[model samples]
Structure formats: structure tokens, C-alpha cells
Target: MAFFCQTDSYATELLTEVVSCSPAQLKTENGGKKETLSGYNVILKDTVLFPEGGGQPDDRGLIGEVPVHRVTRQGPEAVHFVSSLLDPGSEVLVKVDWNRRFDHMQQHSGQHLITAIADSLYGYKTTSWELGRQRSFIELDTPTMTTEQAEAIEQLVNQKIRQRVPVIVRVITTDDPEFNQVRSRGLPDDHAGPVRIIDIEGVDANMCCGTHVANLSDLQVIKILGTEKGKKNKTNLIFLAGERVLKYAARSYSVEKSLTALLKNGPEEHIEAVEKLQKSVKTLQKNNLTLLRDLAVLTAQSFKNSPDRSKIFSLHRKEGDNEFMNIIANEIGTEDTIVFLTVGDEKTSGLFLLAGPPEIIDQVGPRAAKILDGKGAGKKGRFQGKANKMSQRGEVESLLQGVLNGTAPKEE
Candidate 1:
């Protein structure tokens, strides 16, 4: 039989210690070996500096004026990574950038409030959290929720922010009876110490390892940017909080002003102006279609007296507006005729080729596709491809003749 003794698992430290130490810079030589510095991991001893876990990024700061380049978790310990290598066994004073830590705490706490609101409002549980460079998103267990529900949850989160309830952190043994009432994803099986539970008064209680603000008011505002659906019944709820909210608001205001200027209307009237423009575009499209029909008729008349004895007609339509080419192709046909039309619009060009009769189509269709560098196959020997480049009408006509004479093979 063996007996094991228990001891305090958490470390305690004072902020004054971090401030008293002088900052140092390291010079590396000979491929990352022989390091000499008096730097030690700060929160490693006190369990304060955030460790990488739970989809949340670790806290960033300087220790004794040496900026922490990274924070990684090894087994159950958080290894603070500094740019300069440190002596393995040396004990050095450490410091954390209190502002950065506090800001992150506010953001993380705000996320809890918003996610909890989502769960309360729509039975959505946060299955994951991603802290990104400029923003963060909480992934919900349920992928879908009505827009009304999302708006309502956003409103409720803001209301809670206004209420400003106290945030309490309690350390408890895994065997605590009250732990059962706190709905959470449960602790990691590998966690060896006591669990730290963060409770937002009567709002929410969950197991978390990240730092947090003491009061909800410290979070300022939490703005839900939008929601996006993900795989496997999950959705990402994007949001920003505290100082980020102000930055977002300012940027949005600037964008709105720019849009108003471009649209020639105030922000309130922007939607109406856009609708008007859309209606105008729709009307113009109808008129353009009518014009294309008339132009196709004129194009057909020109070909009626074509001088070419081979029945190969090459015509170019205005850049873009493929409707005319399609209309022309469908209207005219000969026993062994191939029609080539090129249309160009400002940005893109189109090509249309129509061949008639099985023998004629087989000879000309593949040749047209080859010459145009496009692809199409049809039972009636019709083919179409966007012109690979503009000004290929002559080449297309020449290829049609070559294929008809059995001199050209089908393009690969």
C-alpha cells in the first residue's frame, strides 16, 4: 500500500515583479545553440499567461522587457516562448502587458455572453471558437436559425451588456457537486489540476482557461457581424467587442458615406437609388433584346445574297451581345452551310457557328471548335465556343474550308 500527499496546484505572483526586471535583447550565433539569458516563463509559475487551447489564442506580452514570441502548451504546462533563448534553470523576473491581456479578456468574456445568448434564444451551443487576427467567430452546434432569432439574440446580448453583471471565477475540484449544474462541454480528460469555471452571474457558467474581465460592463459592446453556415450542423457567428466595436463603427460610417457619395443619395435613400438603377437596367436589357432581334433579321438579309460559292459566311457583330449570333444561327441554314459570327462587348467576346445536315456539320463543326479554340458537339453538326481571341473570323473561315476538303483533322 502507498499514500500520496496533495499540495497547492496553483501558483501566485505579483505584478510588481514583472515591472522591476530590465528588458534584454539576444544575439544568436552558430545555429541556435549556447543561449545565455535570465528570462523565465511568468505565468508558468502562477498559471496566468494564457495557454493555447479551446480554439482561443494564447496571451501575448513581454517578460522582463523581452517580448513573448509564442505561447505553447506541453502536457499540462504552458511554455512561454521568448524571442531570445533563455538559460534552462535560471529564475528571471517576468512581466505581462496588462493592456493587451485586459483587452483580450474583455473580448473573450463578451463572446461568452453572445454565445450564451444564442443558446438561450435559439438552443444553439458554441461548439468551437476561433480568435482571428482582426476578428473572432463562435461556431454553434446547430447550423441553422431564423434571421429573427439571430436579431433577437443580438438584441439580448446588447441588453445584457447594458445590465453589466459581475463576472465571477471559481476554482473547484472535479468532484464538486455544483459542477453538474453548469452545462458545458466538460473538462479535457488530460487536465490534471483543479478546473477554473467562469460564471456570468445568472447568465452563464462554463469551464474556461482564458483570462476574463471582472464585470460585463468592461466588455463595452458586442456586435454580431453575421452568421455563416458550416459543415455538419454548425454555423460561425462573427462578432467584435469593446474597442474593436468602435473601430468597426467608424469604418462602417466611412464606407456608408463613400457609398452615399457614389450613389448620389444619402445613406437612408441608398437602397431606393439602387432599386431604381436595377429597374432602369432591366428596361435597358429589354430594349437591347428587341434591337438584337432586328439586327439578326438584317444580318440574315445580308447573307441571302452572299457572293461566296462555298456557302461559308463570316460576319462580326458588335463586341459582346451573343444574343444576335445565337439568333442568326437559329434563323438561317443551308444543306451544307456553316455560319460564323463574332460579337464583342466591352469585357468579353463571343463566337457562334452553326452547320446544317449530318455530313456538312460533321465536317465543319469540329473545325469551327478547333479554329475557335472552343468546345461544342451536337447531333445536327452544330458547335459553339467563345472566341479564344478577337479577330479570328478569317482563320475560322479558312479552317471550315480545310475541314470540308478533308485536309484538316479534328483538334485535340
Candidate 2:
């Protein structure tokens, strides 16, 4: 049923009678796993806790010393999901989490103010709005918004906040003449009875059921962060209101300070210094790759003078890339020589490569990949694939050696 929060937005606690309480099960996901939790659905005669509605999240708090995890509205009843069931017809103390409630109030009210300003000044209708935990967004009908336009809207909204205008809530019948004057997304088809209208003094009057502060000054400030292109021709404007704006500013300042210290540059020069460092790192990486290629060639040359030069050579390199292995294989491969190479770190997965005579690869490539639990194809005497089970590297090397020595069953 309708509650005190619908009319009085500032109410944080209410002592009400429990209408009903029933056992319920809640299914939730945690860390990619689905879990079923046991709880009870407790309905109160009147509640201060606001149910999740109209893009705003539900309020969380305690009911008679038991934690209320979720509050949802079913028809006119507010359902409180708690761990233990309360007796029907018993009185309970309902407390709303003030921090969460106030944050929501600021963001939701800020959205209405911004939306009204956008429509009034630029004729941009708000298509949708989302009240997020730390940030909020309103999707506009327009495809793009200029930086200057956004700044103007921010300035205008903050000006209203400075005026400290009263935010009044009024309830009126559906047939009331003033109903037509109030702006709204429009009433639901099934909605009946009185309509709650929120009026910002000398600013806007809209039909909304969400809780809001008594005055615009309670919002403290509003910041329009940026905008992104949304679906079709819509533009999503990101913003932070009230204490969230302060929190974001503090976090950003801390990050900037750390970045400046680490980069050994002032705030304005940090970006330039980081760009230069990145370029130097890229150059060093390229040089290091060249050195690795040269080292691979030298390693291949060292094996050239080996007295036991077999037709099939199996090499295991713990510190080299696929390119390095390929270079070594290309340098040492002959018409009859088959080189089986694997390279990777001990802690993670590795790569496998088979290169040499086309006939040998065609016979052994697929078989090797299958044994290593990997997938690949061979063409023009080269086959390469990833080895999923890195810990089996030693076994893979032994299997290759066995195949080469004729101790293991050879591929047909």
C-alpha cells in the first residue's frame, strides 16, 4: 500500500504493524556461481523504506533488528525480504539506510532538474535515465551535445541549487486541472487515484514518486562529467551529484598527484611525459626483439656442429617466444630435418611448433597437437599451436622424443 515515503521524503524510520510475513527463497549470483538463499517476505502496514521503482534502486535497512536485503513493490504492497519471518499483525520498527536514501534523492532530483533545463533551453527530451551507485546518466533524444552546451546546462542547474529553492511534493486527483500542467513521463495505464507531483520553486513541476530533499541546497552541487554516443541517435550524459561529486573530485586529485610524482612532471606535463616514456619503451622493445632474434640464430648455429645431428631434433626453450623458436627452426631445418620446438614460462601456458620437411609435418603435426590437448593446422612444412596444459610440457617433449626414436607408436 501507499506509505509515508510517498508523501514525506525525509522520513527515515517508522514504527508500523506487519500485515503479513511468508517464507521465500532468493536466487542470487556470486562470483560467477548461482546460489539459493532463504529469506522471508514481510509486508508492513506503513514503511519508510522505499521500494525499487522508476530506475531508482531499493532502500536497504533493518526491520525489527533483522536485516532487510531487498525491498520490492508488488501491486500496492511493499515487500521486505528479511532473514527471519516476523509475525503477522505484530508491530516492527522499520529503519531506512539514510546514506543510501539521501544519495538516491540527490541523484534522482538532480536528474529531474537537468532534464527540465535541457528540455526548456535546447528542446532535448530525456529518453531515459539511470541512477547508478557512484554516477548517473540521462539519455537524450539528440545524437550529440557540444561541450559548451553541457557546461551551460551544468552552470544553470548549479545556479538553481545556489538559490536554495524549496522542493514541494503535492498529491492531486487524476482529474485535477493542474495535472495537465505538470510534466511527467505519463501515468501508467493501470495507475488510478491521486498523482504525486514534485514542484521545484520557479523551476519545474513534474509528476514523480521518487524521494527528494526538502530544498535544492541539499543537493550541494552537480557536475556534468562527459557524454557518450548511445544507441541510434541518443546521447548519454554522465554526471555526479551531491557528495558523490566531492568523492569523485577527491579520488581524481589523489590519482593525479600519484601520476605526477611517478612521471616526475607537473600535472599539465604528465601526459606529455608519459607519451615520451611510452615511445622510448616501444623503441627498447623493438631493439630487445632484434637481440632475441640474433641470439636465436646463434643458438641454432651452436647446434650445427653437434656430432649427433639427427633427422628429428626436439628443442625445449623456457625463455623464448614463438618467433624466436620459428627463427631457430628455419635456420636449422633441412629437407629431411624435422624440428619440434616448445617455448614458455614455468608458471603459464606455452606454444608448440613443428617445422621441417612437409612430409613429416603432414604425418606428425595433428598427432602432436592432439597429445598436447591443443588445436592447429599445418601447411607448407610448418605447424604451430598452443599447449593448453603447460605443466605437461615435459611429457610432451618426451612423447616427441619417443616418436622420433621409434619407441612410441608413429602416426600413419
Error of 2 at 377 (Å): 5.7
Alpha-carbon local distance difference test for all models: 0.67, 0.86
> In candidate 2, what are the lDDT values of residues 215-245, reduced to their tens digit?
9999999999999999889999999999999
Q: Could you give candidate 1's per-residue lDDT for residues 113-168 as a string of tens digits?
A: 98788888778888878777578888888867667877788788888878989888
On TM-score, the leading prediction is 2
- Looking at model 1, the pairs that clash are 318-344, 319-344, 319-345, 320-343, 320-344, 320-345
Lowest summed-lDDT stretch of 10 residues in model 2? 391-400
Q: Cα lDDT of model 2 overall?
A: 0.86
Off by over 4 Å in 1: 1-107, 118-156, 159-164, 188-193, 224-239, 307-310, 344-357, 360-374, 386-394, 409-412
Off by over 4 Å in 2: 31-34, 188-190, 311-320, 334-338, 354-383, 409-412
